[model samples]
Target: MAQNILINDLPLEIFIKILKEVDGVSLGKCRRVCKKWRDGIDGSDQIWHEVCRKEFKHSSEIAKRKAGNICRWYHIYKNLKMWIDITTFDKKVREFYKFSLHDKSHALDVDYGVLPLKDAKGVVFYDMSNLKYIPVAISETNCCKVTNNDHVSVILTKTGLYVQKCVDSNGVTEGFFKAENFVLSGEVIYFHNGTRAGELLLYRLSSQKKGPMSRPIFDTLAILPEGKFAVQLDVCERKNGPLIIASTFFEIILVEYDFFPHEQEPKCSFPVNKLTMYKRLLRLKDRLQSS
Candidate 1:
């Protein structure tokens, strides 16, 4: 029987060179091959930095600088593979810029990108890719919130929710659900229904392929106080699973969904304010009395 040449047995310079040539996904696989490979791959910051630059050329220099300051380039690349909705405003004008969450770079180049614009009249969808903008009429009385995911773009107004295919000219589908704020997290879309103080609605898109035909799952994930509103919503992927974090003016809520053996409902921690400390103590006293 002939023995194969082990990867670790190869010269260090040659191994590094070989790893540098492969894509980020392949580099990850190579790390699990052996301890020697792992150390060699992990220790070299330059390799990962180069990979970050190549993979996320669409990102901005500011994002690159920020990521380099925080952690390894690989960490930045892995975390920022998804688009993060970042809003920026000038003296009086507010605009939303899609940024790489990890590196804080613009998700697309200056010319070819989806630019979401808003005004008092309605929400405007700008196709920088084609140098065209479409004004979507919502409600004149209420503000409209717009969000785009991998498959479609959603516009939420006080009276209805509108959705259109990201890559098509299909007319928008209007659903009668007044929303205050909305965000897209992976395949699931999260929105606050009713007023500022409303319920958190979760709508999971079936598949990326059949996006237009995919209907919302119509599941209510959580409920909030009458006055409290969700100011921010984002998904953080972790070792355990994906964490859905919704932040309100009064509190921040974190929900973790884990379905290993069987499908389980998401576990949520809400109103993580100082009041919760007192509430926990009061609950413990009640339990002690019962015991």
Candidate 2:
């Protein structure tokens, strides 16, 4: 008969190798088995990275890019799991929040669990996790657009543009400019200059400092012909840099910006037909109705 071997008697390297084959839920249970197994599981970042890779698929790449060198694999896995639960309509997640808004209130944008709402009293950043609100001291009457990420919040109004650090409510950096539309991604801001037709500007915040003292300066990133106007703007973070998409009434333009050169030519443009435009409008209408 073969000799009976105990799990605790196994070497940590071999034990971790076995744990690698286990799913995240199973790994959590394994932690409860004993101190040795728990330490082995918790100490290895590779295991959590592999788990994230297996579960999140393509999203793992995006999350990794965002997290950078300070890789908190365990936290990343938990965050992704929470996102999955929220997106998949988990009953427990759904039942966590039950709040009503005013009839005139409008949701500006949502990032992570924070929802920025424009209502009778300026803007409020509502934390979905804790059910708390951080009221921003700004007038909503002229506020055209507002967006936030985990780090900062950017707001555009008729008179000017404003940026506030998410952690510090009093730390606001204000800039006076006329922008038709804008999108905030991380520390970068891409906006359409209303004064000049077909002109798009890129503003990058200084990483060394935060708050009112450090203001962002912009440079002209791209310019189209007089008739072509960018109506919609979006930015996606890539391994190298950012991929910007600007949509006009007739065409969609893609521009890639890297750190070294800071600017590059438009990668490509796709023309849009009337039917495609109509379909997009219809979808927007349906979304508004549902909301």
Candidate 3:
């Protein structure tokens, strides 16, 4: 006859090793088993880190950086898990609204509980919280696309790109060049300049103070191959830095902006200047065939 061993009797090292192999949900259940188990799980940051690594492989580092040094690993894990659940889970439609407008409305951009929609008159901000349309006066009637963040709204028209403060609509800053298409990620705008050379430009919304009279300026990032113009653009912040995904008629380009290296250096040291911030990671031609 042999005596049976209880799970609680296991050594701390062996216990943590076993818990590490379990999924996040299972780990949560184990933490509720008893005081000893909860303390054991919560005390080890490695367990939470491992959970985050397995759950959010692509965004773990980015989340950790945003959380800062004082934030605990468990809190970071919970926040990321919540965001994943909110974004990925499917839910039935609760309600819908029909709006009468002149001409077909352009693509709308939503951020921070506000959605900006472009109609015949101008760009109207639909407040998600209050359920009201606050029209922002835009002179350009032929608006192509509209996007915004918490700070400012960017309107792309056939003639030029316009940036206006979200609070004060009176001060509108117009770009010097015409853009075929553009994407707004936070304070940065990545756009395709409507030119034969297929030039991609970057405009920083936060750098308005650096320009004359506090106006934003454009920086030429990269130039695509001749005859290949970018029709669509997307930007996302990754562990490394900001990544731009641009799709042309024939090819898809992945460009990464390296801002971390320069950011890490001391402010007193001379800035490490580069020719261009755009670093092409991968270019796939005939994406449909390649897939």
Candidate 4:
């Protein structure tokens, strides 16, 4: 049997078409074949944009058909975030953007391109091949809190609490968080610069006020530690309380406040980076980008 092995012989446009059929990983391999291939692929960002849309759109459909309600929707949305999350803000997010979600009956098999909605609020995922931004019904909200520390800005209407530099149009904070609850296996310290009388303040991210503020979720036994360090502990929390892991650094140390008659202080320590913390950050950024 004879197999054609002359791929590079094809025209540049044909080579691009070939590149389009492959994926990011495989494409990485393809680029390694020769300098020509590397230059050709590097010249185009359009391919990355196209493949990503298809992957996410299909994944979204798979999530919806999996059978679940809003919780399920959130579950799927979050699970598939790695393939669809875009952090670069449009600055003009208040503008409406065109989008279409899953509609099994009249499903759009667009293979061309999509246009960005002029007045888009949330992140716009325009299918460059079909001129449509696949839609996902999102509940959004935003609110601000004034404080002497860092000029706290928060927005939590219904979707979730966002604490960041500014408020999202949906009233969510543009700032990113680990989640409602997180656990700690390593040492963690709390900075007292903002705490009043050493009382850790807690803000319930919701549109409606349930009660009061300044409620402590859990006290920092050693207070907030400065610089970077590591510790160990066995920390856990329920879905309602995920042991917020947004530590001063990446690790959280639940210092043994009280020792059980038989229990000892936690020996588990949070991982510490000796150099080039950029690796830790870039890994996170990549995950967020894919989401």
Candidate 5:
């Protein structure tokens, strides 16, 4: 009888090469086969790096560019992959809350002291510290987004946009500005009326004064030529300052607004056919409706 060779009997290099062919999920399953397999998979970071690069391309790119020496690529990728698996596989709901509105997008924001929840009718600020719900703007609301710090919030309607300051104890203050589509950064909110093609308006708030009586003071930073039909705003803070990214129907524009020594023009712009995509989506929706 001819001698039979098992998979584990293969050379370590060849075994590792075989393991690299499969994904993280398959590799995880393989690790359970034997102690040798587990040691082979767990001992190498290169395998995880390759896996991360393949699956989490975007996240890997961000980790490479932004995350410094503090974060290891393999570790970040492993945690993220594990998180995705848990979230995707786990069917149980950890927490649940009842709300009146049906639409959930742009409806909830959480901060240290308060939690702001938006509905079609109005916005309700829930004080986490005191356990109280404070209602603000009882009128009909189309869309709303809150700031990261939870100190500011912007509400949108058919006519205009309303920016409100959420105070700790007293109540929500008046609108910071009644503009159109807006996005909140740290202390600044960017918006545009959509009347002027490629016009972007930026407003910075001063949080020097605190309390319900002392409201945030809004000042005009600049009115930039961003893009035609500006629809979205995104902000990222770098070493320089807050980097504003605005996406319009035609393209996406980036602006580095350093307040100390102001840079007038936008840093860069990328052409994107978002309008075409929107139209295609609408047509598809119509066809589905008709079908």
Candidate 6:
């Protein structure tokens, strides 16, 4: 009898060590090298779960850049598909389990703009394409909002804030207020995409609850933006007001009224498109503060 020789077969222990260095998918691919490697792949389910979370974050970041309803649908679905492919176990990833990409697109923006994001709890993924009073909680079949502590806010349709407590899935809402006047900008609630002056309320903040009992309040930070441009500028703390963040074809004027101290008079005006004057005011403030 001739002695049999085998090659390209690394010990499972050795391959497991190597697998630790590579990602779950790559590890899955590595398993194809031989039966021994394939066996190790089964033990790495935790890696696959981690990959799922990473994919979700990556998809959220990508979705934020797109604008408008049509653009959002195009971008979000496209990216979701890409993320699905990123998984080694694509078949196991159900479409129903994943969130939609275009929940808060060009649907409704009273005054300001918000980008976009899928709806999730404990983490606000608001679309910042436009501004609205109600932070919409939506699905393809139904839509609602979580307004107050009860987590069962309902729409009044007549158009205005309606406040009341309830025991239901709809969430509590601030009902007795005006909608057109109560325009929102990421202040009280952290929408993943809306702009409220200079404040970016995206993190999970531990809020101190106040009133009757010192209960920690969890009402999402609601930064109501005064619909006027100059008003919004007043809220921004930048010395020259808010920095005009612009892109190639688009323009934004950050009103500086918010950043300048109440007693100080503006030395120069900053037009919506030009910002050179704003730079001087900032430098002047720095000098004054330093001196």
Best-matching candidate per lDDT: 2
Sorting all predicted structures by TM-score, with the top scorer first, yields 2, 3, 1, 5, 4, 6
Candidate 2 lDDT over 22-135, as tens digits, reads 898888898899887788898998888889889877766565543333235665565556432222221110111112433322544334333444555554454332234433
| Candidate 1 residue 31 C-alpha distance from true site, Å | 1.7
Q: List the residue pairs that clash in candidate 5.
A: none
Candidate 5 C-alpha error for residue 289, in Å: 39
What is the per-residue lDDT of model 4 for residues 124-172, given as tens digits with 9 covering 90 to 100? Answer: 2232211233342112211111111112322222222333332212353
| lDDT digits (tens) for residues 208-278 of candidate 3 | 46545665666555666566555655443322233344555434454544333332213242111100100
What lDDT would candidate 4 get against the real structure?
Answer: 0.31
- Decreasing lDDT order of the candidates: 2, 3, 5, 1, 4, 6
Prediction-by-prediction clash tally: 1, 0, 0, 52, 0, 38
TM-score against native, each model: 0.33, 0.39, 0.35, 0.23, 0.29, 0.21
Please give the lDDT score for candidate 1: 0.44
lDDT of 6 at 209: 45
Question: Which window of 10 residues has the lowest lDDT sum in candidate 1?
Answer: 85-94
Instruction: Please list the C-alpha lDDT of all candidates, in the order they appear.
Output: 0.44, 0.51, 0.50, 0.31, 0.46, 0.29
lDDT of 4 at 136: 24
| Residues forming the 10-long window of minimal summed lDDT in candidate 6 | 228-237
How far residue 34's Cα lies from its native spot in candidate 4, in Å, is 0.8
Candidate 5 local lDDT, 1-291, one digit each (tens): 999999989998888888778887787788899899888887876777778888887766554332222224544464455432221231211111334544424233333223444555554554332224533333344434433233444445555555444432256443434566666555577887755534444333323476779755543333445224335554332222334444444333445433323322234321122222223223322332332
| CA lDDT, candidate 1, residue 72 | 47
Candidate 1 residue pairs in clash (backbone atoms < 3 Å): 60-105
Clash number for candidate 3: 0
Choose 2 or 3, whichever is better by lDDT: 2
* Clash count, predicted structure 4: 52
Local error of candidate 4 at 41, Å? 1.0
Q: Residues 1-291, candidate 6, lDDT per residue (tens digit)?
A: 996645336665565555556654565477688775565565654433344345445543333222212122223333344332222221111111123332322122211122112233211223222111223333322112222211222222123333333322254322344342232222242222223532312222234544686744332212223331111111111211221221111112221122223423234432321122123223322332332
Backbone clash tally for model 5? 0
